[model samples]
Target chain A: MTVTSPEKAKIELRDVRKSFGAVNIIHGLDLSIEGGEFVVFVGPSGCGKSTLLRMIAGLEDVTSGDIFIAGRDVTELDPAKRGIAMVFQSYALYPHMSVRENLAFGLEMAKTPAEEIERQVQGAAQILKIGPLLERRPGQLSGGQRQRVAIGRAIVRKPLAFLFDEPLSNLDAELRVSMRIEIARLHRELGNTMIYVTHDQTEAMTLADRIVVLRDGRIEQVGTPREVYEDPSNLFVAGFIGSPRMNIVDAIYAGDGRIKIADTVMALGQNFAGVAAGDGIKLGIRPEHLNVAQSSSTALRAKVDFAEYLGSTRYLYCYLPSGETITVEQRDGRDLSSGEEIFLRCDPERLRLFSTGGDRLRSANTAGMPTA
Target chain B: MARTRNSSARRLFANIRYHGFGIVVGLLFLAPLVWSVLVSFKPSVEARQPPLPPWPVDGFSVQSYDNLAQYGSGIWTYTGNSLMVSAATVVASVIVSLFAGYGFSRFRFPFKNALFVLIISTVMIPFQSILTPLFLILTKLGLQNTLTGIVLVYVTLQLPFSIFMMRNAFDAVPKEIEDAARVDGASVLRVLYRIMLPLVLPGVVTVAIFAFLASWNEFLAALILLTDQNKYTLPVLMAAVRSGQFGTIDWGAVQSGVTLMMAPCLALFLLLQRYYIRGLTAGAVK
Candidate 1:
């Protein structure tokens, strides 16, 4: 019962906009998603990431523009006709039904033959590794197990794409991490296009082939996780990605590709276009890039406010002379006390510079990332 | 010694006060139903005796049960009518209310809040105020004494509160589930049928039971709407029988008939007690 890949299309959206009466959401978003690629829309709460996913799935009506899925103009089509399956935050399992029945629900609705439906359900159950739990209701299973059943339910449909709206948000933290990997693996095996929506940055970073970062109903940046992280398009993406988040400190352009921060003139060896001498800018450095400076390197002197020590690393929360704080990820596990004087050095090449208006400035040659 | 004495006094007083109050209240409410069952087994003279029928029944006989079957005209017919009407009311009201409730809960149209307020306001209006006009309207439509008329009347009357219960039920259900359903190729109605309906079933059942009981036990409207003895429902017949049209009350027959009328509702509650109490605990979980 294999669906013969159905000639999947590069889902393209042109000036897609949505609104609720006078209040507009999703302000003129334009994006093109290639076939067989997994894209995740990640944002802070109330950013309309889920709203965008719903629009793609045809659950929401697009106020403006066309959505083409598989080369079919489906902007005004019914959800059933749109060829997408969704896994929800709450799983949306039919409580009265067993896992097997839940998995077979979409097929049943489609009026598939009973044997084929059974085969599809069995295949999904095996894929999700929830075959043993197939006879149980969602209420009878644990959160992780219910999530598997939810995924299995989607797989049975064998749609052109999968839409997930924070499917792991209901689970505990540990389970979320594991399920995140499982979903990534599922995408690899299925080789179908998938679009997931979540507010969890880890979910976006770990799972997305291309991450769509949204803020306040508008897409801030869209790129691969490495592309978005290593070369963020905006200051929002810089701050949003990474665990011990990227530190943003106010700095001024200092006569070259260099920036002056808190009495420290850092030498950036590359030339940045459109950056002027006195332009107010912010230096963005990932915690892992900043560390304890030794032997008189160009350093930003700071006092450690506190430290959060993980087994493998410790995050030194340090503040510059002007009072802006930056986290230094010390990998060698040095135990630093509060108010300890420290010199933090970022290897200038890895420093992310954003103009005051929050746009990522294109430098001539930032060593780790391609300048755009 | 003072601490120990005070603790003992507190325990003794607490046990007497709380437990005593609960027992008294329970007995006060339960006494009549227990008395009703007991009195039904008593002989005609014993039922209304100055001392009242004896507890545990001095002697129970089937004479009343037999007399009820033989002497009560249209009693079984009326009971059947009540069952038909109420069952129809439960099914019809639940279906219509579920749709309207979903609409109110999910969709936003122009004047949405005003529409919801209007629906809720119907609940606050006294049924007695609209009874005459409603009856006249039904009469003009040739639905006056028919079971369909009764069902129609019952459904419309029950709809307001039914919608209220179901709207809250739909609200308690995560809207994300329906969104998921829609994304899973379900149409709006399919989403309701597949995902939303089953989750809110306990609430729907609770509303249905209420609808069932209201229509089954309804007396005033049934009395006004129906004239034919065969068309009379249980409550209407029960009220008429209580008048004791024959010189002295045939307490045996009346008791047995009352007992019979109570059986279905009791059985229904027992069968659906799980869902009935589930309404209380619906949104307790996050």
Candidate 2:
């Protein structure tokens, strides 16, 4: 962990903006990543997460604004002088270089002493468990091995921060999981600030101390995994952060703390003060939050459409009487068959309300709880 | 067991058909070189036969090669000139094209595509058509009868296609590799020379081979530009010997000269054929 110093490094982007020709890619954005924090930029493709990472690494120029790494302005500096290292999605190990040469190349370029370079290269190789593959060329290694060498190459640089651009994307599912774990372990052991970019929310959730959710080049929400998951700032974050996505359906706010879906009325329980009676609202619910009820009068009526069985848990796909589709996760082995009628129940506290424009609408009781 | 046997039999038949066609086409291409080698061993009178047979009926001898050595300034002079011109062309063209192609592939400037298209369009203008102007320019540069003139012209002619091929070769390298190298503390030139160039070496070999062959075997430019027989390349010298001014053509000398010309080309392909095919196919896919 004392590769450089255990001291953590911070990166700050001040009103950063990027543009290509007449098209703007990253809007004016401000963010501060604390020292040693594992911050993940998660978004769908074309959301400029990779662009932002490249800008921070100085591989891409900022259309406007400044970037500071460890309190030094690096916006106009070359990538080499910025003291950053990146692991590319392609694994970009020089095909002509052996694994040892690949790891030693940056140090050699910097005129590091031969013995010291050898020590650092061997140290990285051992850490990544690639000692046996040191002499082999990149083409001789598997996808996983190549990625390990790439990480080793980055590690030998002993940079202040590490930038990962979808590093696990080219790996197969099993290898991706293991490599993800390896990256998390590397972050913990190195205790260096790392900014990882990925479209996979699972990677973002498991790896990041804090996640930055982006939509159309703008920051949607930045918070801890639980904060983003349990309390999303907007509809986009709620739908994007979870597997299979959250079910969003239309509802009408009925008077006296009640919401109506079809002919069924549900109690708000907590007062959502700003909502007026008869105003249209969008309801968001996680599949695990919806329970299958036998015969409750307050339950929403639905007919089973299909079910996906996964040994321990099953997802039931259903259609409401009002023609909306709902997904419910069941673990109790409820023998719900296709085309059969069923009732679904949701806890009042688990319900999420959004105005028609997709902003999270907070109830008065939860207003002062926490904001993401 | 019967089905397995049947599929194996079908696969064997398919293999025969594929390789059978390939062998036939390969032999067709090899026939001329084989014939030239055979004729080079034949005595002068037998080599002049209307249809030169595969084997010399009059018995083999090294007489034609000896004849080539005895005539005019001799075959070694022409061989030396050809080697100098080809080597210079290969080195110059490959160096210019590697940097130019990398620039075209990685950097963006005003009218970049237009410039690339402009360079590529030079390939469409046949070398034969530009002979007169090239000769005039050589004379104006006072390089009219010099090996440097021939080398300069050869490098110019080889560049358009070489640059195009090298551009594709560089493009085949993922941009991420360059970015990774940049962040790894390599300067741009270091990235090109130490990283990118080595990876695209197959393409460089391909360009070198093409340039060497173009300059080595070139006839028209050398013929027009160099009026001095001593400075003539192998092909031009062979042409001069083939059309005997007052005497009958020295069939043995011409055959040996040709066999000599074919030697380097054959050896080059034998050595670098793998890279030749790889260079052509590398950038065709991802």
Give candidate 1's error at residue A153 in angstroms: 1.6
> Per-residue alpha-carbon lDDT of model 1 for A1-372, expressed as tens digits?
223354354678889999988999889988998888888998889899888888988888999988988777889998878888888888888788898888887888888999999899889887888889888888899999999998888788888888898999889999998999999999888888899998888888888889988999998888888888898888998999888789999999986777889888889887787688988898899999987876354788999999997878788888889988888899876778999898888887799888899988877554346433
If you superpose only chain B onto the true chain B, what TM-score does each candidate give? Answer: 0.88, 0.94
Q: Which digits, one per residue and each the tens of the lDDT, describe model 2 over residues A1-372? A: 123343488888999999999999999999999989999999999999999999999988999999988888889999988888899999999999999999999999999999999999999988999999999999999999999999999999999999999999999999999999999999989999999999998899999999999988899999999999988988999889998789888999886778988778999786675688899988899999989888777998889999999898999999998899999998789788999998889998898988888988888666656685
| Span of 10 residues, lowest total lDDT, candidate 1 chain A | A1-10
Q: Highest DockQ: which candidate?
A: 2
Q: Give the residue spans of candidate 1 off by over 4 A.
A: A1-8, A294-298, A364-372, B1-28, B53-59, B65-72, B145-147
Structural similarity to truth (TM-score) of each candidate:
0.89, 0.95
Angstrom error of the Cα, residue B160, model 2: value is 1.4
Q: Look at candidate 1 and give me any clashing residue pairs.
A: none
Which candidate ranks first by lDDT, i.e. highest?
Answer: 2
B239-280: candidate 2 lDDT, tens digit per residue: 888996487887777878889998999899889999999999
lDDT (0 to 1) per candidate: 0.84, 0.91
Chain A only: TM-score per candidate = 0.94, 0.97
